[model samples]
Target: MMSITFSGWEAVKDRKNLSANEEPKKGHCYMMYHGTHLQNAKTIISRGFQPSKDGLLGPGVYVSRNIEKAKCYPLTVDKKDKVVFKLQVRVGKVKKINCDNHPMQKTWHQNGFDCAWVPPNSSISSIRSGREEDCVWDPSRISIVDVACCVDPATRKELRRLIQHNNRSGGECDLCHEESDCNPHPVQSCWQCGKTICAFQQKHHCKH
Candidate 1:
């Protein structure tokens, strides 16, 4: 279970381009950002800005087996930006795919020679704000390991307030019979329909 942390938009671009095969240089290992819901804290936490997926990249995260030898360049967009969040990933869970002859490549990229494929169930672990450069282990051929962390108290309070205010009355969840509680803490809100949903029931409410 190797852990690598990257900050700034450059890392973000590298992650996306590596997944898409648009990167000029190909390495044995790559890093990806799977936490999309943390977009609000992207710049603040060094989560990297989301790049447009209009190119050869598919809609999933991809990584190389040999990320230690991977070389990163300076930011082309924002050079002076400081490192924000240290994205920690447990690479032991990654599933390998033959980038050369994977069937999914046909749909992912028009030119099959480019781009990579991400296996199902790939996820992220913890993320922090700091400058920690250490390579703990290699994720190339390791099995999955369990890792968990608690949410911050301030974030929890804020979520609770947001849920209560957005839910209001008559905003019962379509999936679950339970209505918004007096101390509701919604994880997702539908601005189009003005509905608030808890984290557990977000999938049933939104299509995305």
Candidate 2:
């Protein structure tokens, strides 16, 4: 129910400097619009909403944002008494999800999480890993473990059951196999080498 309303969309028709009439900027493309739900609603737009064919705004570098439509912005008033509705504010393209960036070093990704290299003087190693000679992030050095990745061993084990549910083992293991000797075992016994393996396994441990 809290909203700021604008009036006189008709008056902006003659205001050539207003954005709705302009073609928008080219580089670092961004656009903003303002208006109201009233009879004489007014709007001001900054750049193209999104790249398009007939509305061909930019073919080069452009801003990227989740809110691509003008109607999605929530209307709110600032402390300075300025009525503003901001939607789809795009700084740039979506390079990665779960990403973090620091000013001084290289950017990398781990377990689908983005990582930014640390500045030379800004990093200190964690006591847990105890490798202070190496440069590391000082912010508790969060290590992301991918629970849904196929490459990481732990994640592959976690996801194996989901992806290969119908495979040889139905994600169960026999306690009998844990012991040295057991005849009838629920664990998967390799058909080739006849070695009992855990039901929940990434692969049958066949060393041959």
Whose lDDT is greatest here? 1
The local lDDT score (0 to 100) that residue 202 gets in candidate 1 is 24
- Model 2 regions more than 4 Å off: 1-80, 86-93, 97-99, 102-208
lDDT of each: 0.30, 0.24
lDDT tens readout by residue for model 1, 1-208 = 3432212111111234233322323222233322223224323222223433432234323222223211121224231221122122333222223333445433533333233333322221111111112221222211111111113555534434543444344445554444432213234455444455444342433343
- Give TM-scores for every candidate, taking all chains together and pairing residue i with residue i: 0.23, 0.14
**Per-residue lDDT of model 2, residues 7-108, tens digit only:** 211221122331322222211222232212221111112121222121111121111111122222123522222212222222221122111233222322
lDDT of model 1, residue 160 = 42
The candidate scoring highest on TM-score is 1
TM-score of 1: 0.23
Candidate 2 residue 7 Cα shift, in angstroms, is 43
